[model samples]
Target: MFMGDGMSLPTLAAARTLLGQRAGRPGEETQLSFEAFPTVGLAKTYCVNSQTADSSCSATALLCGVKSNAFTLGLTAAVPRRDCAASQVPAARLDSVAAWALAAGRDAGVVTTTRVTHASPAGIYARAAERNWETDADVLADGVDVDACPDIAHQLVHLAPGNQFKVILGGGRREFLNITSVDDEGTPGKRTDGRNLIEEWQADKARRNVTYQYAWNHEQLLQANATLPEYLLGLFESDHLRYNLETDHTTEPTLAELTEVAIRMLSRNEKGFFLFVEGGRIDHAHHDNQVHLALDETIELSAAVARALQLLDEKDSLIVVTADHTHVMAFNGYSTRGADVLGPSNMRDSAGVPFMTLSYTNGPGRRPDVDGRRPDVTLEEGFRSPRWRTHVDVPLASETHGSDDVPVFAWGVHHEMFSGLYEQSHVPHRMAYAGCFGGGPQACDAAAAPSALVMPLVMALLALLRALA
Candidate 1:
């Protein structure tokens, strides 16, 4: 399963329809399919009604098989009202698939294009108060309620009695470093709590027979061999990793690179593994209404999925790919194959046709200038106006997530379990069921017992092959 970020079922369906029609010949029609997890119906049935399927609840549902209130991780809706299990004293919470894998002695890892503490990946490991609340010196020194779930950084270090995860990679150095600790660039800072989380992690790893390596850049990551560390930490920045579209000072690794490294490290475990990879920035792009940025991130996510397919053996390993939620995107007109993905706004008139094309719907106080012309300066500089001028008119509304059901695609042992639409919370349970983590017949049971007992396609092919040979 390859999950794309902010993928709207309706928008994707429209795009596929256009692509098929454009690709089809007079007599032939092309069929297009959506492979991300579908959205749940009945309002709070699939998701807790919130402003959006923000990563916190979405990821919680994906990983823990529970729908949480928005912004809370690893807690049930009754957490606020009833003080659920996660809100209690931390012994060892095993709600996450990652935790289940760790408990089963299988290696587990999480890789993301955002801060490891961010909602999507953190949903797998850390059960915290709010996704946005990272541990600051002031917050911690105030004798923060230990019973209140800690941030991802604290959870990564102290989730299990022992360091549980074998591999942990992605940004969020600020969360690990003391509030006062300056970054390697000699930047001045202070550890607010006067305790260095990185040192604590290293010391803990050394004492617990765990090898630990923390890498801040691509060079450091490449230098550290798979043999060195059973537990790895790669936080390339203080916050979210740099987006692939933006060139920045930070040495961020692409999602594909991070996935490859994690697979190599985690596969060494004999018990097999479960890893969660997130293309988190895609959702961010959608929130900002940057379609081009969103599509680019989606393509990168596809590349990572392709990498997973290349690395994993389908016979033993189950790779479940899915997104937490959907964004509201649409395709109003017929768009040709490989049409300027950035579209006409970036083009200029070649002849009688107006060539340069770019577009956007209404966003943040955007209005036409006096003459209905493009603003002189950049969109960022143009206040009280919409950016990304467009000839196409969309419904006047802020961008949002659609209520429509999304799609999920699966391949490998239990891939068939993902065939039909299901509730978002059912995903983790399905994967766990397939992976043999949950108590049930493995996904292969479904695969082995086919419906209606049709003739063996393999046998038919073999007979044809023998005849041809």
Candidate 2:
């Protein structure tokens, strides 16, 4: 499964247009990798306590198959954010699809541009009361018992499912190291407990006698043998990976490279594997109102999905692509065909000022009017820069998520089941059905006929079973 964080319909539309223009064609005629999927659906992205869901709540819904309260990860709504006592309750703690995959004797792995302990990736294995409690210092600062509520970084390295992962690749090396220690890049770690989780992860694998490799840079990742290692842990950056436009390809791996290596290692399992690949920086860019970077990250996500497809067989494998939530970024304006998406719109405002095609509803991008007039976008230096923030109506530190349904695109192996609208929580259940894992009805079960060709037989067996009972 793959998710583009904060990649809304408008975001995809804009990225596709930008892609087409880059391909030297009319911008509207292009399709991203997932757009060609046979089954397409929409998922409502509201949380249990909020109309507009944050990454943690949405990640819980998408990965755990349950809607959770805002700011919580891998726990049900019964556990409110920052409730350390409540989060410890096993009933309140939810198991994600990774647990389900492991229960069925399949391996699972996670790859993201964000820190492994960040909200989205943490949903796979972490059971936390708060998303921001990524380190011991963070939990203690929030007045929570550090030992009782272990930080997310500790949970991933020492806990179940996460330790069993065949592949764990992403940024955030600092989260796994101690404050006193520095990484190869001389970056200080974030842990205050004086424990280095990265070394612990390596030591654990060593004790198990498994072939594992730990990589901290692009060269290290490339040098690691994909087939020889039973496990792999790669942390490319101290924080989140750099924006695609700013990254040095020699030191930092692209999203596509990470996805490719993950697939190569995970596909070795005969029982199959469940991999979660996330373009997490897309959300970060949108939060900063950097439309160019957001679009580039979306394109990077498409490339990653394409790489996964190239390595898998459609006959047996399943690929589902969707977003956790939408953003407040708006792509508007009428311009001539093949016009630059990054350029100003053809239609001017009431003040005869041309605004960029992209803009945010609320962000630091909001510029104060001069003499009761909107500034001309074309006149500003760095206006077309990748880090440029477009126009905004409301002034805020960061843009918020939009309360809109996200699109779901599914391909391969009973993809038809993904058709039509559904709640965000049902996503993993549908995936479990297709993969024949978890407690729910599955394609492997005779009574659950996902395909039309077997509906009659399924009905006959259902009737016979009811009669027998």
Candidate 3:
């Protein structure tokens, strides 16, 4: 499933029009790819500690079948946010659906536009007290807990049983490499412990007698063979991958391309695969109040979903597309039928001052000019230009996440069960039930298995007939 982060219904409403304008079409007639999914459900995204959800809490709820506090991942709500001590409690640690999939004899993978260890994607295998503990530097920055938790990147390479990932792709090479090593762009490393985790990862795989490959750019990843049983990793940027709007196609593959490669690598397993693909930058764009950039990110995410659908068989595969939460960006002002979503509204207030068709409820670039003065920007330049920043009601440095229910779009096997409103924690249950993995309702029944008696007899008869011939 595709996640358009901070994508409320209104954000999507504006984005649909904005996307068509970018394609040289009338704004009203366009449809974002996932709009066509047959079943749509609303998910309540509140966390136990806060009304509005953060990515860590939402990630735990959706991936681990439990709701957690704001900054924790794979832990129950009982663990206080950032309480490094409580993070080690056995009752607080929850296993992910990915772990369950592995136990069910399925391979698993994770892909994202953000760092592989970022909050939402780390839910695939990590169980930590804080999402910010992405590197050794972070652990050193704060008071020590009774038990020292390894950073997120460390967990990916050296996690416990049932956490073996077949593929892990996205950014954050700086976290893995040594502080002395320069990045692809010749930037200094972010690591403090001076460990080259990439080498460590390869060495660990070799010890297990496993075929493995690591790629740092688009071409390298494309050239790697997926037909062979191998663990593959692609880290294209020191930090997060560049946004789709400004990235070079040659050096950076789109999210769709990444999804295709990941699926192919994981699909070699006869037991099947579980892949988590995140359009992670959409949330960043919204936080920066970059309307067009956010929508573009969403467009790329939708394409990734479409590509996955083509690669998967609907009969056995279950695809879920939903957002972790939303933004407070307002899409009002009665602009005409064909008005640009990224352009200004023709209507003005009593003082006769023009405003944007889209504005956030709270964010940066929001100014209160009592003298009625405005910036020198025109519709031709649009909000995308470096000079223009969208105005908001509140003048905060970054936009706040909204508590509104996000939409869940599902297709493929057991798609019928995704209807009706539900709690976010209920998601992993539905997924487990659908895939026949974990302790789900359908996992225990003998009927869940393929006809045991009939299948063996059929195989024996076929073998006898072949011998006779």
Best by TM-score: 2
C-alpha local distance difference test of each model: 0.62, 0.92, 0.81
lDDT of 3 by residue, 113-182 (tens): 9988899998778887888988877776766541377788888877853238888889888888768888
TM-score of each: 0.76, 0.95, 0.91
Which candidate number would show the highest lDDT if scored against the true structure?
Answer: 2
Looking at candidate 3, the ten consecutive residues that score lowest on lDDT are: 375-384
Tens-place lDDT digits, model 2, residues 81-188:
899999998899888999999999999999999999999999999999999999999999999899899999999999887888898999999988889999989999
Comparing 2 and 3 on TM-score, the stronger one: 2
Per-residue lDDT of candidate 1, residues 342-445 (tens digit): 44423333332332223334333234443555443233353212224233234444555555555565667666666666677877787777887754455545
